[model samples]
Structures are given as C-alpha cells and as structure tokens.
Target: MASDPFDRPNRNSSSFILVGVPSLETSPICLGILFCSGYIITLVGNGGVLLVIGLDNSLRDPVHCFLGMLAVIDVVMVTTIVPKMLSVFWLNSTQISYMACFVQMFLVHSTTSEESGVLLAMAVDRYVAICHPLRYQAILNRQTIAQIGLAIVVRALLFMDPLTGMVTKLPYCHSHVVPHSYCEHMAIAKLACANPRPSGLYSVAGSSLIVGMDMAFIAVSYGMILKTVLGKKSCWKAFSTCGCHICVILLFYVPGIVSIYAQQFGSGISVHAQVLLADLYLTLPTVLNPIVYSMRTKQIRQAVLKMLFSRKVHA
Candidate 1:
C-alpha cells in the first residue's frame, strides 16, 4: 500500500505540522515565563495609557489626543504579534497553516503601518501646536483627529493587502519551519517554492513608502518645532513638551532602521541573533512608551495616581 504524504514523516506535504527543523535552544518553561511577563507588562502599560487618556478630561487636548491614538496603535501592534509568538514558543511548534500564517502576517503589517501613521499624525499635531500656535485650536479639531485615525486604519489595511495576497498565492513545498517565533513576511517568503522576488520587492517598496514618508514628515515637523522652541523664551517648557515625544521617536526609529539594514545587507549576524533583535524591536516600545509618557507628563502621572487611589477606596 502506498503511504500518504501526511503519514510519512517530513514528506514535504501540506501537513498542519511543519516538521524537520531543529528546535530553538531556549527551554519552554523559561520562554513561557519571559513571554508571559512581556505580555502582562505590555498590556498593563498600554491599558494604563488608554485609561489615563480616556478618564482625564484635561488630556483631551490635541497633542494628547494624538498620543492616546499612538498608545492604542501600540496596543494593537503588541497584541497582534506577542500572544501568537508566545504560543509558538511554549507549544514548541513552528507549524502554522498557510492561511493562518498569512492572517498573522497581515495583522502584524497592518498594525505596524498604523503605528507609523499615528506617529506621523502626532508629529503633525505637535507641529501645529508649537509652530502654528495661533491656529492650533482651529486647525486640530476633534473631527480632524477622528479623520486622521480613520485614515491611518484604512491606509494600513490597504498597504498590507497586496503582501497578504502575494504570500497566500505562493506554493509551500513542505519546508514550513518558521525560524522566528512569529510568521514574519520575509521569513515565509524565503520558504516559498516559487520565486518570491516580486513579493520581496513589493514588501521593500511598501516599507520604504510607509517608513520613509513617516520619517520625512516627522523630521520636517521637528525641524520647525526646534526652530520655534529655540526662538521662545520658555526653552525649558518647550523642551519638556517635546521630550517624551523625542524619546519615543528615537526608540521607534533607531531599531527599525537597524533591522532594515540587518535584514537587507548585513551578513555577519546569525539568523537567531537577528530574530532576538527583532523581538526586542517589537517589545521595547510597548514596554517603554507608557513609562515615558507617565514619567514625563505630570498630568498623566497625577491622573493615574488619582485613578489608582479611587479604585482602592472603592475596593
């Protein structure tokens, strides 16, 4: 009797379990602990950011309005990737159905693009507030913010749709072991039987369009912010307003640029090392963003403390 491909071990069939790969070095127990800790911290921190913004009426201004959106985007970004990654780690299974993998990839890319758009919106908000103070209130109304948010969501969805289609069309010839914890687009593209050059090019071009445009807008906004701040007499106040944003901008951009270069050009680093770095890039912003805003923004800090106290008293 002839054996089914699924019955044979590592037969390069469309089995749900992508087999024939060496397991990662980390113990499942240790990986589980770390992953859980990261997830909890990310959730708590981003949740706090949302709560503080929503409850504190004073933070409903244009600048914080954008900050709140940024926090929401971060929450989506972390939630999309981290939980699935933890499952992959703890279960010790690198297997994902082609459809499931494409979905995950789509969500990750969508959230990432949304985040970039939010950052760009925030920078524009800052520019209006600082550089065009006379027209700030008139220009950055609630309706405008709502429109920006909608635009971000729509743009992210559209930008990622092409890559998702490309990935799903590619033939998977049984070598489905994803080296990373998550179903990264590039990693999956590498495993396809057909030439993924077109997908690769599209991915790179999309990244350039999104990241490049965002960075350029942020740069121009900050340039005007810098000029306005330096021209003002209250230098300290101006610096304080922009300080948290500056930290977040650096946190978001530096790792992103490095990862792009590493993936595209660097050869000295191992894939495992690159994977670890990518994990860091994914996690650090979620962990640090709330801390930056809470510690730096006195209003948010006081609001958080008041909310905690109120909760305790109610309890």
Candidate 2:
C-alpha cells in the first residue's frame, strides 16, 4: 500500500503537481497569507504606476514611456506565477496542465528576457539623455520607442522558441511533482526522464547570450556616461538621472546572480533555501521596480500624487 502510494503518477501524465513550499506544506495558512499579500502589493503598485503614467501627458517623455512598458512587464511577470502560487496555498490546487506549465515557463522566461532588454534600453535612453542632450529629442522619438518595444518582443521570441522546443521534447519518466511554487524552466527540467544536463546547459547559454550581453551593453553605456560627465554639475546631473535605474538594475540582477552561484557552486544548502532564493530573484524585481521608480523619480512621485489628489477631489 505504501509503495502504491508512491507509485508513478504515470509516464504519460498530462499534468504535474507543483508542490508549493513542501517544507512548509503543513503551514499552508502562513504561506497563503504571505504570497497573497505579495500578489496584491505587486498588482496595486505596478497598476498605479501605469495609471499615473497614462494620465499625465507631461510624463509622455521617452523615459516615462519606457517605465510604463516596464510596469506592464512586471505585472505580466508577477501574474504568471503569483496567482498560481496563491492557489497552491489557498485552494491546495497545484495541478498545472502540461501545456499550461510550458506556457507559464515560456511566459516567465520570455518576460524576464524582455525586462532585462528593457532595462538595457532604459540605460541607452539615459546614455543618450546625458551624453547627447541636444539630440535626445530627435534620437528617442515616439517612433524609436515603438521600434524598441518591437525589438524586445522579437528578441524574446527568438530566444524562447529553441529552448521551449527542447523542453517539449523532454520525457518525464520520474515523479510529476515539481518541488517549487511555480513552473520555472530549471525546476521543470529537473523532473525530465532523460538527462537534464542539456536543459541546464541551454539555459546557461541563453543567459549568456541575452542577460550577459545586456549587462555588457549597460556597463559600456554607463562607462561612457561617467567619462562625459566631466565636472561637478555634470556629474551630479548624470548620476541623478541614473540613480533610479541603477537601483532597479541592481535589484533585478543581484538576487539571481547570487542564487545561481549559491545553487550551483556553493555547498550543502537546503532545497528550501534555493527555492526561496529563486522566489526572491523573480518576485523582488517585479514588486520593487515600481516602488523604486516612484520613490526615486520626482516626476513620477508628483504625477502619482496629482492623480491621487484629483481622484480624491472628484470623490
């Protein structure tokens, strides 16, 4: 009877059970509260940013437009995982259909790539604003923003197609229980019946090709900005312009970098710790980007305040 309980769900199972925080599975109430709170906060914070940006024409500048794009990405990125996570805790419903799991995996990675590319685009925008102040208008017009958005979509598609195809080919002969709150690529890959090494290698290669390249570009852009800002006034202005972005970049990248090293290179860490790190890697950026921008950027703060006050007045 015990053996039967542990038997394979089936080699051809049409879905996988996401074992959300198995170590804390006994305390579903606590986990449910925590994840649901994070979900609400993310939706409200990001949604507010988008609303304020839309309402304020003064914020229709290229920078704010890019910020609006980022807000949308954050909302999508968080939506792909958090709601399901909440379900795991609240309803104890963790069974994600096979195709739906892949779609979630695809959306998570694709949106992550888009966010990284968007950050790089924002860095370029700042570089132009600081280094070529006079030509900023001509260079980063509405047409250029549209082109950048289109390019981001194309980049995400190009990267995800091969990776998703490879993952789709994987045979899941082992347990169908994924030991995480979500259907992340690496987590799902770990369950495959065949060798998972190729999937890991492909992920590393994709990261190098996408995130690594974007980081290099951002570094180069910042380096040039530093050189161009020669004097005190210029230095202050340049740094001021980049302050919010730098915080966002660090918040977005640092967790994943640390977690990767900790998981693959570091020794003797528990699985729960690794899962927590992964959660932070994705969740922190989505939750914090809007908060960081609203707090650090005066124009955004003022716009949000104005919108709030206007609503209150109408009420």
Candidate 3:
C-alpha cells in the first residue's frame, strides 16, 4: 500500500512530499517524458546561445550581454525544479528534505525576480539604441552593464531572502504534502500549522513591488522608443531590432502573470490546472527564448550557423 504522506510524524525535519499535478497522477510516465523533453530543449537552446555568444566576439554588446544573462537565469530556473519534478514522476520519489525545499523555493523565486530585472534592463537597452542611437554606446558601456547585472542580483537576493526566511520560521505541523511539483513559496507556506499570513503578505507585496516596478519601467522605456521612432524613415529598421526582445518579454511575463493570479485568487480553479499553468509559466520561456531570438535576430542566426558549420568542418 502507498503510505499516506500525512502518516509520517509531524516534525520540522520531516521531508515534504511533492504531489505534483494530481490531474496527471495516472500519467506519470507521460508527464515525466514531457518534462524531460522540455528540459532538454531548454538546455540546448539556452546553452547554444551562451556558446555562440562566447565564441563570437562580434556578438558582444549590451543587448547580447542581457540575453546571455537571461539565458543563464532561464537555465537555472528550469534546472532547479525540473530534475526533482522528473524524480517525482519517474521514480515516485516525491520526498524533498526540509532544507532542500527552502533552497529550491528561494532559488526559484530569486531567479524569477532577477529575470524580470534583466528584461527591464533589456527594454532600456532597446530604448537607448532606438531613441538615442549615438549615445547608446556611451549609456550602456561595459561598466554600466556590469553594474546593472549586479543590481539585479542584489535586488533579488535582498527581497527574496526575507520572504524565504519568513516561511522557514513558520511551524509546519499541518501537512507537508505540497500540491505542486517543487517547492513554491505559498504551497510550502500553506503547509504550516501557524498562520502563514505574514509570509503570504510579504510574498505578494514583494513580488508586486518588484514585478510591477519592472513592468512599469519597461513600458515607459518602450513608450519613449516608440515616440522617438514614430516618424523616422528608419522606423521599420528600429522596430525590427526590438521585435525579438518584445516577443521574449511577452513569452516570459504573460503566462507568468496569469499563473500567479490564477494561483492566488482563482478560487474555482482546479489544482491540476493551476499546477500545469505554473509549470508552463516557468518552462515555456526558457525553451522558447533562444528559438525566438535565433529566428528573429539575424546576427544570432548567422553566428549560430557559423559556429555549427565550423564544428562540422572540424569533425
């Protein structure tokens, strides 16, 4: 007989069982296959971008710098959860140590916040390139890019640490069976015997403050870029340069916001649906961002082709 997770002793040291998507319970093999495939695509796609960027000197610029950062974050974001998710599906190994759960929770949330910051930075890069083309080099120099990257990391760590800390301090005597695949903040928090309101409130507030501010800044940056390029003869060219970034932004944010809101307020939403949405929110962008960039950006396409052909010749 499959033992009930609740049958385990209620101790802070007890491992949490990640139930994964209850709707997909009967299809664990299928789900595992899907996750495995997505993880491969994410690794190959993002890893290809990073490789091409490293090999091609001409690809080094402010925009590519941010793309590289985004790819790194995407790889981390998916890797943090997908392996454990696969274990749950394939081996029925749903148990996650208490410390490991908190670590996963922190990494997932921090990487997400950092990705948002990178997107905002990319938006500013586009705005500068389009609106002040001459000053673009001056504004987004190597030093400035480094500083921006540092700021993004620092901000995520600062905000997410407190949220994770708040959750860790909560007493978890209620239940340790997390409904979703991996350790999401609220899912873990809801397991606590004590009131999780403070942690929940901090999560909502912190996410809103960071994501909302990043979205607002990105919007304003794009607005100015549009205003500057509206009547110019080079308008089409400028728009083309930003098209890939815009698509990447939408891919990352749209599903994410939907999943987050649906999880938070959609009372009637099924756990299966919510879990699927969350999985998509995390995995989709990582898999698609490199493909979109390769298709849309001529330089990346050319560089990638060049790298592949060179390797082929060597082989």
Candidate 4:
C-alpha cells in the first residue's frame, strides 16, 4: 500500500526557504541591482510626495489627501517586502522563520487591501470633484477623509486577520520551500501537509471581493465623471482632472490582477515568469505613482517644483 508523502519524516520545516525567481539565482547581483534601484526610487518618490503634501498647506485638499494616504500605503507595501527580497537576492538569506513569514504575509496582504481602499476613496473624491463640484468640499472634508482612512485600515486588518490566521494554523509538514520572493499566502499554504483548498478559496474570495467591489466603484465613478464632463463645454479640462488618477488606477489593478491569477492557475506559464510578474506587480506601481501624478496633475507638479526650487535656493 502507498503511504502519504506528507506523513513521511523530513528535514526541519521550522523555517521556510524563499526561492526568489530560481532562474535568476545565478545572476543574483543583477537581480539585486534591479530591486535595489526600484526600492530606492519607490522610497524617494513616495516619501517626496508625503513630505511635499505635508509641508505645503495649499496641497491639503481632499484629492491630495488621498494621494498622501496612497503614498503612505505604497511606502508600507514596498518596505514590507523589498528589504527581505534584497537579502534573498544579494546575501542568499532565504530562510524565514514561521512567525516572521506569517508576519510578512499579513503585512503584504493587508497593505495591498489598504491601497485598494485608498484608491476607491480617491475615485469617489474624483467623482465628487467632477460630478458635484459645488458639494466636493462638504462631501469629503477633513473629518470625513480621516474616517474613511480609519475605515480602510480597520477593514483591511479585519479581513486579512482570518486569512493569515487560517494559513498559520495549517500543518506545514510538507516541503518548506516557497517559490516566490516573499511569504505570499498561497505559496505558503501550498506547502502545508493538509489540504490547502479552504485557505486558497478564502484568499481568492476575499481578494476577488476587494478587487471586484473597488474596481466596480471606480468604473462607475469614472463613468459618471465621463458623463458629466462630456456635457460641459470644457470637457477636455474636466477629463484632464482625472488623467493622473486614471493612469494610477490602471497601473494598480491591471498588473495586480494578471499576476495573481497567473500564479494561481496559469500552468502554461513558467514559475520564473510568475514570480517576476508578482515582484513587479508589488513594486512598479509604487515607483510610477508619484511620477504619473507629478506629470499629469498640475497642482502636484507645481508643488513638487516649488519644493525643489526652494531646496535649491537653500542649498
């Protein structure tokens, strides 16, 4: 009679090994350089946005408020994953303790949820600004934005707690090798000796709900924004208002959705390609958001220029 492979004795599964893009293992230095460069840009770009918006009272409007919140979330998302990834890429430090692995999983997923929530809130802000220009101030004032931000954080943690908790409770008697850069939930779940379908289903359902609802709302918001703008004589100007946010929305959702599903079901795709997509999905948006906003939104562009000019004078 055949026996269960999972029941067989094996080496220590106390800590999981993260094999970050196995194809790139031989070129660790190149991968290290790429991630290091991206991490630096993400930090400087998002940090500059936060700093500029904080110091400039003129940039304290609701749109900029949401942008600042997004900057904070981007910083959290990248910081949670990038340093560990650098260690794996550069120093060959790939083992992550069980507790530490779950912590990273929680942070990565929770921050992704928070970013989605912030994007939804920003979509609403755009809707109000374009569709109800007169009521924009009363609709998304300081207090309301604060409440929304609080809700975003609370909802993200509350939703992610159960998912991570379930994965943590799983008996990981199987191989402790994770095939991705960070402690991605499903990647870890698949390593458990027990059936991982329940956790996988929950993760898929939760992710689908968050992404679906947020994308639907954003689409509807833009639809209404488009309708309102087209009726006006200054349609071009109105559309220009949403240009940066639209670009940001595309950057956030498109790659993310593709990478997630590819990891889950794209058997035809190579694991290395899947890992690369996931890594880029986690990172590219953070590096691009500030640059996109700076180029598209006049107010932010001016504020950033002003900050740089003043710094030059001080120098």
Candidate 1: pairs in clash: none
Q: What TM-score would each prediction reach against the true structure?
A: 0.86, 0.90, 0.92, 0.91
Sorting all predicted structures by TM-score, with the top scorer first, yields 3, 4, 2, 1
Candidate 1 local lDDT, 37-110, one digit each (tens): 87798788888888888888888887687668777777777787777666655665546766677777898778
lDDT of 3 by residue, 1-315 (tens): 877644664576568889989767889999999989999999999998898889899998898999899999999999999999999999989899999999999999999999999989988987888778899999999999999999999999999888988999988876678889989888888888888878887777788788789989998998788789888997787676566667767777776676666665556778888788778878887888777654466788899888889989999
Clash count for candidate 4 is 0
Off by over 4 Å in 2: 4-9, 234-244, 258-267
Q: Give the lowest summed-lDDT range of ten residues in model 4.
A: 4-13
lDDT of 4 by residue, 8-91 (tens): 444666888888886777888888889889999999998888888888899889889888888888898999998999999888
Q: Pick by lDDT: which candidate is best?
A: 3
Q: Say which prediction, candidate 1 or candidate 3, comes out ahead on lDDT.
A: 3
Candidate ordering by lDDT (highest first): 3, 4, 2, 1
Q: Model 4, stretches more than 4 Å misplaced? A: 1-11, 231-233, 237-244
Best-fitting candidate, scored by TM-score: 3
Candidate 1: list runs displaced more than 4 Å. 1-24, 27-31, 231-233, 240-244, 264-266, 311-315
Backbone collision count in every prediction? 0, 0, 0, 0
